[model samples]
Structure formats: structure tokens, C-alpha cells
Target: MVKTKVITIASVSGGGKTAVTEELRKRLSTSEALYFDEYDFEGAPDDLVKWVEEGPDYNQWNLEPLKADLESFLEREEPPAYIIIDYPFSYKNDKLKDFIDLSIYIATPLDIAMARRILREHLKKTSIEINDELDYYLKFGRVAYLEMENAIKLNSDFIVAGTLKVIDIVDAILNKIETL
Candidate 1:
């Protein structure tokens, strides 16, 4: 049986975690990729400002569904050699920490991430809606993003520049994994 290593890629919103995870999966023949956005996690904060003000606890979000799915994937007769996840919490969440063999944090600049997010996710929205969202981001969301990044980066085994090309990022991650 191949020993599967769980590798998690963490980054702020629009920091290319998903892109890197997908590209890495394609390059690694015996790998599976999981995305956090695919699951509706319980205890996820609805108000970022409030959450941060309350002294954010990354473990507050229950990741049981993700954990369950991960276990099921690993139970396959021919389990993957690597399990890559585009997760936000890195090893900060107690429930998922033990399963992580390697934690990677993408250090993306706030401005760059915000630009990417606005261009990618808000194109369909009206101008007023986009403005309102940006206003909110400026007011409260930035704090949450910064806090999350700091926490994850502190615990991560590796840090990749989010400004790198997707292929380059994947190369870096693969190289890091090889060293491990």
C-alpha cells in the first residue's frame, strides 16, 4: 500500500491556492485534490469583523465533513500517494492538523489578492455591489484576512509566493515535497 501524504495549501481569498492545488494534482500522477469551498462547513463565521473582534479561533469551523470525505478517499483499494487540499486553516484547526503531512502557506500580498478577487469573482456584480464589497473589505475583511494568513503562515512547513506563476508555484511545491 502506498503511504499517502496529506499536503495542504493555504492562502487568503483569491491567492491561487485552488489553482496551485489543481496544477499540482495534474503533475503528480498519484495525487488527489480536495477543495474547501466545496463543503459547507458548520460554525463558519458569517461576520468577519465580529469573528476577528472576538479573537478568531480557526478551529471554530467544524471540518468533520471534510475529514469524513478525506478518510473515505484514503480507504480506496488503490489509495493516492498524495492528498492535496486547498484549505484555509493549514494546521491551525485541531481536527485536521494530525492528517496534514505538509502545510504550505501562500504569501500573497493583500492588494494583489484583492485585485484578483474583484476581477475574478465580482465581474458579474453591478458597479454599486462591487463598490459596496470593496468598502466592506477595506473596513473589516482585511483584518480577518491578515489574521488568518499570519496564523497559518506561522504553523506552515513551507511558504510559497502567491505572485508566482501557477506552474512555478506547483514546481516549488513539488520540490518542497521531494525534500520531505
Candidate 2:
């Protein structure tokens, strides 16, 4: 049985990773694509909320559970199973080296990401809560950005310009995967 192809879109908070991942997922959903947000681990939502209300120390805890889930997903035997993962892979873990088939790093200017975050905050119903979250993200996002840069330089298959259209980025990634 052919192993499933896994595509990871990684970047700092406010980067277009989620948007690109969502668009790719929508396009490939008919092909039975499995969408996974690394942050969707047990207690992640609560941690995220806490981080928003308080600060970034919350994420400093272990991420082994999330890594385990990713490893399991990658090891599954299923052909034509496209998994789009939205997460920031910074650490030099064995799992990171093993599971990722194609890693696309979205490179955007910090100001641009901030602007996008502001827009996203405006679109949210809970503006206060979202703003708090955004604030925390904005502060710690820089560190994530640096880590992401290292990760991308070390493992990425491609570094897409963040200004490109989502469709174009998706197409580029799909094309690369097809060749492999």
C-alpha cells in the first residue's frame, strides 16, 4: 500500500499558513484530504485561550502529544490521502525529520501579517477576546518567525512568496508532490 502524502504549511502566527492550508484543503477535499491543525491537540484550545489572556509561557510546555499524532498520521497506509498540516515546526525533533513529505514555508513581512491579523480580528464576533489573542500572538510571533526561518532553511521543499495567490501556491505544491 502506498503511504499517504503529507504537506505541511508552516509559519509564525498571523502568517498566511492557515489561509493557504484551508484553500488547499478545500481544493483537495474531494480527493479525501485530511486536514490537521497542529494546535488541535487535547487541551490546545484551552492553552491557546490562556495564552491569549495571560502570555506565551503556556506554549513552553511539551508538545510530544501533538508530535505523536502527526507521526501516526504520516505512518497510515492510504494512497491518494493528502494531509495538509498547518503548524509551526521549529524544533529539531526526529519526528519532524521523518514525517514531512513537503514543507512549504510562507514568507511574509511582519507588518503584512500584523495587518492581516487586524483584519481577522475585525471579522471575529468576539473582538475583545480575539484582540487579546492577537496581541499575545503578535508579541511571541517574532520568536516563532525566527524558529520557522530555521526550520524552513533546514527542511522546506519550497519557500513560497507570501504575496502569491493561494491557488498558485497550492498548484506549485501539488506539482512538486506529483513529481516526487
Candidate 3:
């Protein structure tokens, strides 16, 4: 079976990874996309702090099924042209190393990420709750992002500024793919 071209768009929360992935989906033909945030893990806690600090073991994720799902796609009669994963944890997953043809890091700074996260998440939350959320993110999310940044940078094939317009990022990636 021919191997599918797998791409990972990784960044911390509110880093515009979703925007880039959405743009990619719209622009790419015959593409299958996966969002890590959408994954349903049986024993996973809703608590972000515990999930981040406890690391991979304590955080339950049904990723084995994803591996199989990806394999199924690759083995198909006409395999998908691309598989894009918009998630932060790809750096830590060795299983994906062989599958991923390219890794793109959306390098959004911490302050920008915080602003975006607060803006996106504050809709249903009260002001006080939003403050608490920011605090929690500052304490735990920042730590997790910091810990993962170096590894992600080293693994990435391309580093794009996360603050750029999604269309620009899309154009950059499309051009890069054409060259490749």
C-alpha cells in the first residue's frame, strides 16, 4: 500500500492551529482531517490541570483506534492524498514519527495565546470565572507549553508565525507542498 502524506499542525491552545487546519481542509483536495480535541477518551478527566501535569499516562486517549483508522485510510483502494492532525501532543507521540511526512509549528507567543484563549472561552463564563480560567491557564497550560516547545521546534519541518492570517499560512503551506 502507498503511504499517505501525513501532516501535523501543532501549537499550544489558542495558537491558531485550528484556523490553519480549517483553511487546509478547504484548500486541499481528497484530504482527511483529525482534530485531537474531538477525540473521546473513556477515562479522561475534564480537568485541564491534571491532564497537563500528569502527562501522557494519566490522560486517557483512544489513540490506538486513530492508528487503525489512519492505517485503514492508507490501505484503501484509493488512499487520501493527505492526513492532517491539528493537535499539540504530536511531538510526544513516537508512533506518529514514521507516519508524519511534515510537521508545522504555529509559533504563537504565550501572550497572544492567552489573549486568544481567554477571548474564545469567555463567552459562557462569567468575568470571575474567566479570571480563574486565565489563572489556571497561566499556571498549568503555560508550563505544559513551555515544556513541549523545544521538542516541537526541533521536530518541525516548517515554522510559521501563528499570528499571520490563515489565508497567508494556507498559501505558504500550499507553496511548500508544491515545492516538495
Candidate 4:
């Protein structure tokens, strides 16, 4: 049986995790990718501030759905050579840590991430909506991003510059994986 290597790319919002995962999947013919945001995980907090204040337990966001999906890939008779995931917590979540063969953190500056998020997600929003989002980021989102980044960065096996082009980031990841 072939062992499918799981590589998780972690980053704050708009920090290139998804982009890297997608590009990596394209480059590796025998690979598939999963995204954390694509699932509605149970136990995820409704309020970001409250969660952060309450110790921001990474496990609080139940990753069972993601886990199940990951298992599906692993359980396949002909498992893909690589399973790339656009995940945020890296190995922080105890439940999912065992399955992760490699964890990568994308260290994007917060300001750049915020700008990208605004442009990508809020471009069609009214000024008031944009302002509201920015206000929320200032008051709560920044802290949450920092919390996740600091925690994940410490646990990741590799770190990449989020400012790099997606292809460059993917190349770095591929080179790192090849060395392993």
C-alpha cells in the first residue's frame, strides 16, 4: 500500500495558503487538496474575541469534518501521492496532528494580508461595509490572526514568505518536501 503524505499549508487570512495548495496540486500530478474554510466545522466559535479571550483553543474548532475528508484520501485503495491542505492550525489541533506529515507556515505581514482580504472579499461592498470590516479587524481580527500565526509558526516544520508569488511558494514547498 502506498502511503499518502499529507502536507498542510497554514497562514492567516489572505496569506496565500489556498493559493499555494492549489498551485502545488497542479504541479504534482498525483495530488489532491483540501481547504479548511470549505467546511463548517462544529465547535467553531461564533465570536472571535470571545474565543481568543477564552484561550483560543485550537481544538475548540472541531476538525472532524476535515479529518473525515482527509481519511477518505488516505483510505483510498490507490491513494494520491500527496494530499495538500489549506489549513490554518497546523499541528495545534491535537486531533489532526497525527495525520499531518508536513506543516508549513506562510508568514505574511498583517498589513498585506488585510489589504488582500479587503480587495478580494470586500471589493464590492459599500464604504460603510468596508469600514466596518476594517474596524473589526483593528479591534479583534488582528489579535486572532496573530494568535494563530504565533502558535502555528512555532509548530510548523517549514516556513515560507507569504509575499512571494504563488509559484515561488509552491516551489519552496516542493523543494522542502523533496528533501524530507
> Which prediction has the highest lDDT against the true structure?
1
How far in Å is the alpha carbon of 119 misplaced in model 3? 1.9
The clash count of every prediction, one per candidate, is: 0, 0, 0, 0
Q: Candidate 3's error at 91, in angstroms?
A: 4.4
Q: Give Cα distance to truth, residue 9, candidate 2, Å.
A: 0.8
The parts of candidate 3 lying over 4 Å away from their true place are 1-3, 42-62
User: Which prediction has more favorable lDDT, 1 or 4?
Assistant: 1
On residues 1-180, what C-alpha lDDT tens digit does candidate 4 reach at each position?
657889999988889888888899999879999999899989999998778877878888889999999999888889999999999888889889999999999999989999999899987899999999999888877888888677888889999998899889889999999976
Q: Name the Cα RMSD for model 3.
A: 2.8
- Write one digit per residue (lDDT tens) for candidate 3, span 1-180: 545688889887888898899889788888888887776755656775566666644225546656677788788889988888886655456545668888888888888888898888777888889888778766666766774576676668888887788899888888777755
Task: Order the candidates by TM-score, highest first.
Answer: 4, 1, 3, 2
What is the C-alpha local distance difference test score of each model?
0.90, 0.63, 0.76, 0.89
The C-alpha TM-scores of every prediction are 0.96, 0.65, 0.84, 0.96
Distance from true position, residue 177, model 1, in Å?
0.5
Give candidate 3's TM-score.
Answer: 0.84
Cα displacement (angstroms), candidate 1, residue 64, comes to: 0.7
